[model samples]
Target: MNSSMFNKSNATSSIGENIYHYLRKGIIELKLKPGDSLSAKNIAEQLEVSRSPVRDSIIKLGKEGLVDIVAQSGTTVSKIDLDRVAEEQFIRFSLEEKVMMLFIEKSSSREISKLEELMEMQKANLEKKEYNTFLNYDDEFHSVFFETANKQMSWELIVSMSGHYRRLRLITLWDLEIAEDVMKQHYDLLKFIKEKNIDMARKTVQEHTMRIFAQKDFMVKKYPTFFKEKNDEIDLFNNFKR
Candidate 1:
């Protein structure tokens, strides 16, 4: 792993939070591979901080299911749990569909214009092969509906629960075709929303949100070490019930 990736010049945040963000970003970007060992002491030495902050960050990451801490053993980046990803996908799709319904009812032309601007940005990023930046624009496009509908807190909650899904998405960014397809989906969804076609918008959102599942087999085969074996008989709804 490149320790320099963790190095940052900002000093506004607490050391623990800074370490947490660094490790989280590395994990999401696949710099810290699944099952890779994480040495708190070594990271502390590299960051020129005491182990306390690193340990705190590790514990926080553990709570997020991003890392596993074994007693008398060492910490390792957690394998991508497909079950968690599916659960999060479901939650996000359901909530966002509801938010889109509300947005369609109340959205003004100005808000629609904002989404169009984001779509243009996504197109530009795609043309430049800036997949990461394109993903950021994609996120912002969806977020506009939530922000306009006064659901920013709900958006935050969904994002907090979407770590695994987001990491999986980051891996998929290498597929330029998928990026292009997603941009088209964004455009179609935006069109539906602008037309006040709530049903079409909801369907579009559902299809777009669940489309990643189609690549499950390919992703697992390509990155075998990053995924854990999930029981075929497991009931996703039951397992993820609150």
Candidate 2:
């Protein structure tokens, strides 16, 4: 923990952050498996906190697409759906490709080096089979490019949508071949950005995103239970919207 993180105020140590980190990590590491029922009372008791904090944390998780709230059934860890994953990837790829191209055009050598350092950390975490660590570092690695856009709102939107499909990304991380491919793509993208190759950087980012999308069918087949059931009647009705 750093001093900046530890500095306490009214907001500090609030039940929200405590509960949020607990569930966020659980979901990220698959500790709380998909469709597992969330017990607010149990969690609050375990952490020696009140249910209010846990409830707030649950709402945060819901916003991140990690929890499902049902009026009659209570809250459960969210199940992944292929269509939602595809939709999120499309949005992410749309923004990030442009961000990568912009970064390649405008970044200094210092910024490229920062990304390289994060990639190195990601590689080490992967070698150690630390999937969560690798995911965090990998996010940092990508954020370098996004931050260059100077569009903070876009970055937040990207991360929120990306969190929706985080479980799929976890699956990709488990396959060593896919992990190696990701690392290689990271290196390639970094090299292009450093060399001011905007076209190559943009293409590389698109290819990287598409590679994951290509694995969608495989993932869906292997993890059929991951997706939620779609309400096709509602979709059909929505299609007739004014």
Candidate 3:
């Protein structure tokens, strides 16, 4: 795995904090991948850091549900938890739908054109086959809605809770068909916004953001081990929640 992403400096954070950030980014961005092994010794050697900070970061990541550390065994990146994904997606859909509707109601054509520019930039990255940059633009496009709607706090909350969902989205976006479909939906979202059609905007958000649930079967079947499977315990807990 290319562990070089951590090299980008954050001067204030401690060595352990930096390791935690690097490992978390790798896990979330699919560089390390679900179920990929991580050794503190190897990581320390690779990073030219001591094992103490490396181990500390792994423990911190484990607490955040991004990694699993087993005594006498090893640490591995955690698989995507669909239950958490579903819950977080619902949270995202609720907030983002309202954000989009608000943006449409209040935004000028000039603001809408700015969104178009972002889409064009995303498209350029896709054409260049740089999916990571494409995903970054995708984030900027959506963030503009929250920023414009004055819901930056809600955006931060959604991001804080969306580690699993983001990982799955990264995996999903790698498919050309799916990526193109997502881009088209983005365009349709802009159309609804330009028309100031709240109903259609709601529909688009529901369809576009919630499409992941529909694709769950495809995702699980293709990458079985990367997703957490449902089981009796899970069903029992869900039933209990009701």
**Predicted structure with the largest TM-score when compared to the true one:** 1
Q: List all candidate RMSDs to the true structure.
A: 3.3, 5.0, 3.5
User: Scored by Cα lDDT, where does model 2 land?
Assistant: 0.76
Candidate 3 — which residues are off by over 4 angstroms? 1-12, 232-242
lDDT of 2 by residue, 56-105 (tens): 89988887778998888899999876566666777778888778767766
Ranking by lDDT: 1, 3, 2
Top-scoring candidate (lDDT): 1
The C-alpha lDDT values of all candidates are 0.84, 0.76, 0.82
lDDT tens digits by residue: candidate 1, 34-150 = 999999989899887789889999999999999999999989999999888887888898899899988999899999899989999989988998776777788888899899999
Count of clashing pairs, candidate 1:
0
**Cα displacement (Å) at residue 115, model 2:** 1.7
lDDT of 2 at 104: 67
Task: Tell me the lDDT of candidate 3.
Answer: 0.82
Off by more than 4 A, model 2 = 1-13, 229-242
Estimate the TM-score of every prediction. 0.89, 0.84, 0.86
